[model samples]
Target: MADHRAQDKLAFLLSLVPYLVDHDRVSVAEVAAHFGVPQSQIRDAVRLIGVSGIPGETAQYQHGDLFDINWDDFELNDQIVLTNRVAIDDSPRFSAREAAALIAGLQYLSALPEHADRAAVASLMAKLSRGASAVPSSLTVEATATDGTLALIRESVSTGVQIEFCYRSAQGEAQSRRVDPLRIESFDADWYLRGWDHLRQGVRTFRLDRISEPVITTEPITFRAQDVTLPETLFEGSPEDLLVTIDVVPSAAPLLADYIPAGAVTTEIGGLFRTTIRVSHYHGLKRLLASMSGMATVVEPAEARTAVAEWAAAGAARYR
Candidate 1:
């Protein structure tokens, strides 16, 4: 979902660059009103044009000032004229490995239970990988059932059957609990069982991966039609609650943008773009942070500072 939204925003922004270059000194208010975006957002979009360029700026397209945008008199004089003819064209580039990975990832996302619309997913995946002609010949993902735990959980939730299971917490601590199954969910590449715990007397999310023993229940449970607990609060203590910010390149922004809330991301006056995201856990954040190595930079939560330092130290040690 995040990936889809980010790509949409990138397409929107990239689409605007051509328009801006074509009609220089465009009316800020007019552009915003036309696009249904805030005036500030349009200004940011103009700033983005200043830094983005096709390659070496030559006679065809000037390097830096290809789109000579002047927002100084932007408010009163809402007209922006293109001093240089900036040729904005989409040159799609992808490595064989990257192309293959994208195909594999799309397949995994499409195969999830929540994303049962395989046809729609396939269409979208094809659209995303249009530039990459090389298609993966065969892709298959597998998940071994935990002694009918998943089947039992689904039936138990529908049938209002109480269940007991031994599970491991995120911290790898062992726990045994009885819960009245409510709803099952898949998030961030894992399935979760959201239910009302008998002992804790509160809502809990049990990770399907951490279920050590088989789920079994002798007693019948009553499933309430009304929600007993807030869905937002259920993930409060999880890593998804951790807020993170990073400055990313435009190319990478399409991947990270949707993870952040709309209107939360903004470009600096100088044209550097940044995104803020609320991650669910430390491990997930670590993985995400590691993947975007050079393009991503951590910007908030001083606590993450320690983790960054530790990671850097580890890398340094490896090199040494």
Candidate 2:
């Protein structure tokens, strides 16, 4: 628990500085809401940062050695306005082992939903590789459950039988599915089962983590690997998919990588980036927007914004 707490604090500090650098002048409440932390914690962090810095050649604190902040604005208006920064460009370069460990953990996070806190994990993985002092070692997610999931998928694929399971989609909907297991594929640390779905009467992909109570049916497979041609790409937008245009703040732009397809372009206007992403429904779009903190806005499809507004209002009403 202590280790986790320390890691969380480190992550928060790393993200907070970049966000502050981007905005320059932002309220404490806004920063707290953006990072989903308490105002007190943010205040404590700012205070700690004000006093912490590297020592000069004198082996003691010097004028330019420490960070400085607008103390009056912070105390009087509860605003974060950094006045001076020290060692801002000098990040601690990670060792080969350190880089490998962080890359492995980030690969694990890639399997989970991209939320406000973890949105930058995928992007940070690449930065680590480039910024590391030495070559990073081999890395992989050490998930024990993956072993059992792979075993069941392999059994169904080898026997050419149908696999039945409860699948939980990204939008939080759970449904039963019977699929003729065709192939087991992987992207990063995430494992996906692509097969012929009897329920939908089409080919579907299932994330192994979202699958539960999986059982192999005696029924022979209707679509074997040889019978079906799998797409070169993992995800193909369907007719049911809704294209949503959203405006994301510059600092939070990396969070949209998972949503933007290959060769897709983003439009920048007034310092905010506009991008389109495909979602199954308005509810899914709302969920995605909620995960982005306050960094994203629905720029098109009035209904999508309405859905998100209603969701937010309902959530706020609960507090009252």
For all candidates in order, the CA lDDT equals 0.65, 0.79
My TM-score estimates for the predictions, one after another, are 0.43, 0.45
User: Which is the leading candidate under TM-score?
Assistant: 2
Model 2, 50-137: lDDT tens digits are 8867887898888778878999999999999876666663778799999999999787655432221344776687667756778799
In candidate 1, what are the lDDT values of residues 1-320, reduced to their tens digit? 99998897788777786666444246878788878889888877667666655545353444553555554565457665544333443355565567667777877665443344567777665544533434444555565664257666655655566878897866577888888776666665567777788878878778787886656587787544265744653354444377777777777776664367646846752455776876765556776777777877777777775777687779879987
Off by over 4 Å in 2: 1-150, 168-176, 182-191, 199-201, 222-228, 250-266, 313-320
Task: Write out the backbone clash pairs for model 2.
Answer: none
| Top candidate, metric lDDT | 2
lDDT of 2 at 179: 91
- Candidate 2 at residue 290, lDDT? 76
